[model samples]
Target chain A: MFSKESLDNLILSKRTVLCVGLDTDPAKIPAHITGTTKQKVMEFNTSIIKATHKYCVAYKINVAFYEALGMEGWQILFHTAEYIKSHYPQHFLIADAKRGDIGNTAERYAKAFYDEMPFDAITLSPYMGIDTVAPFIRRGKFAIVLALTSNTGASDFQLQPMDDGKPLYQKVIEKFSEKFGRDEIMFVTGATHSPMLKSVRSLVPDYYLLIPGVGAQGADYLTTLSNALNASGAGVLINSSREILYASSNDDFEEAAAAAASKYEF
Target chain B: MFSKESLDNLILSKRTVLCVGLDTDPAKIPAHITGTTKQKVMEFNTSIIKATHKYCVAYKINVAFYEALGMEGWQILFHTAEYIKSHYPQHFLIADAKRGDIGNTAERYAKAFYDEMPFDAITLSPYMGIDTVAPFIRRGKFAIVLALTSNTGASDFQLQPMDDGKPLYQKVIEKFSEKFGRDEIMFVTGATHSPMLKSVRSLVPDYYLLIPGVGAQGADYLTTLSNALNASGAGVLINSSREILYASSNDDFEEAAAAAASKYEF
Candidate 1:
């Protein structure tokens, strides 16, 4: 369980706000690490965490990658979360599972991540309404809701103007921010939309923004960091998955991951 | 692989469009069915499916409940999905996991549900834009997108009027419907918002509307069915989870579930 103050202290002590995304794909892991897909994924994840934990303050496990691996995917997911919780107890662990549902279902998801797993925060979609987000708003746990995303399809609805002439994403931030304090809630403002992040920062000045799309998605690192930073100089957790995880497709993949992660260190 | 034609054909043959939702919670299952939580969950799910298969044309497995149970939850989820796929191949299986992410992550979720599991359809949130949904729009599998949900929070964003004067959900349906054919897409129109189902039907007349909120959420089953039906007198799969699953907490739970399901059989 992490409060906003603890997150800030972690960032301040680490001097880097980089959150290495463990979007680990079995096929993409180094071929030299020999075993079944599940074994390889487990080894790859543990090794990556061991190598990169020092360079960053947070580790985001993209649940979809493990989920794609079948039943053992859940096993790997559990083991990875456990490994991070036990080994790197100081680091913030995030489940990059963009989950959302109505109240009861949302409660179930909260139980899945918060009680069953060792995640400090879980990403969620606020599309269903506030009830979908209500269950995740706890004292120490953070509910990182999706705001201006990075994909081209964001133009479809998120960036569209609402009846009030503001984009729908702004309304999402305003509505959620009003309901919950900055400590319990954070917003995912994509790095690809860095320029617009200034507007997001203005809406939720004290809230941390989980920014993805830096490396593989081609967003400028400094520009995103600059635009997304709050007055405290620590309100963003910029993530890089493919760029850092697949830095090298060889036995030295972990070493490469560390080096890639090191570059983002403040 | 279910197409629109095949789905309609199943509805015609089955006589009822009831989608029995397996939102199985460990704490909620019958105490008489003894075992570990996982074993009990599996048994309860299998029995529920066996008892109610005749009354419903589809089964929606809410992923959150299984996820709440930890690692074995995935095992039960897989076994339950396998049980339905092997026994009732005619039934449309929906993994009610409202997932959304960027394109690459979305691709991973597609593999997790479509390739790794036996789900015919997966529910998704459209807040991130169409890119999050693009990967799920494929050949036989349906991408059931959220539109006009039945929760009180629906008033927050989905029901908020867009600059175009139409609610945001209308734009979600209009945009997605234009990109993907009704054969590959379905909309989750909440039964609680039954009156608005008429407007949704007008938007995508031929697409299947997966309606929840009927039983436990207090929406009238008959009224939802009437409003959501299209020109084919089909296009809706009304789902009832708690009302059917926990109809009797005693040993006769399965029997009670069957009786409850039979009531909805047209």
Candidate 2:
């Protein structure tokens, strides 16, 4: 049972909160690795991971990359996640999988992302209310719900006020945070939403936030962090995936990646 | 390349609308299947698929069964969906993976559910707003959003009024039907909400509805169907799992399953 304390400690000791985003598109995978399929994905991820393990505290494998390729993709995803767990066991692992459903339906989702995939945490959408989210925040694993996301379209409704005068996302964070969620719950805030981080920090003063949209998504680290944390100073899992992973395409790719990761230390 | 039209026609011709829920739990699987490892899941699902292909119109393999066991669970999930798809090529295959996310994130989620898994449709939650849904309804793959769930807690917020003075679920269906959706978007209306079905029907008259909460969950099919159908003769995909798949522990399991599947006509 990899606890949240363990993840937080890993993040602390590592000094690098970079969740190496392995959203590897096959075509974008180094040319040598493309045509070989699953094994190639594994080999490709292995090199990148091995090279940058010293710099990152987490590895976030987007399930879509593997799933899009069918069996080969899934095999690669499993192998890739397994490789990360076995090799960099101390690093936080997140199945960048956004899964949510009904209670019975969510039970299976919890199993897939938490139990089967063997990731420390999984991304979740809190749309169908607390029941849809309860399954993911079970015993050991954490469920990172989609709050104010990094994407440009988030403001369309996530920030809109509900009939109760609370914004929809605020209702999500406040309501869902109360349901069976202790340290197990986290939120996805974009680095781009640095402006709203202060209000968000006031709302969810304690829960961890898995912030995307930093690095290649053009979110500034210090500015975003300043807005995310409350009086507690413990709730920001600042994630920078793309810019860190592809910091350089040269033979010194790993070094470039490490440098990029180092740029976001706590 | 599996068109929604092909799936619809097959469902129409077969006179069955049952989406066989394959929520496989390792403890529940008969011991005759090997160890509780990945192989057993794959093997058990294969056997179930082979034995019950004749009776089902669609195989809804809830992602959790495989996910709970970890990597092996997903492998089983992938192979099972592929196996069932190959075995019953005409049957509509759904990943019953209720997935939704913010827009860009939703695109990745969509690829994972639709492109990667190759399921004809995938379940979703619309609480995040229509922007969160558009990606899933891309091109031809149908998006089954959770409209009004069957759970006791569905009343927690789904029926609450939006700013527009419409119930949240009604607004969701109406908004979904008018926006980026046509016939490709459907709703997951609980058969337990039989009386409320007509309201759902009147709201989105042309869209399909995947009605679960039958048999084991306790919803009368005929009554549910009568309420769910609009004047267009559309809507209603009644799903039954544990009640059908495990209808009997004896050798008559598949037959019992067929009997259950027989209950749904349109």
What are the lDDT scores of the predictions, listed in order?
0.90, 0.71
The segments of candidate 1 whose C-alpha lies over 4 angstroms from its true place after superposition are none
lDDT of predicted model 1: 0.90
Each model's DockQ? 0.91, 0.44
Model 1 TM-score (2 dp): 0.98
**Number of clashes recorded per candidate:** 0, 6
Model 2 spans with C-alpha error above 4 angstroms: A1-16, A32-35, A138-140, B1-13, B30-56, B102-117, B127-132, B138-140
Clashing pairs in 1: none
Docking class of 1: high
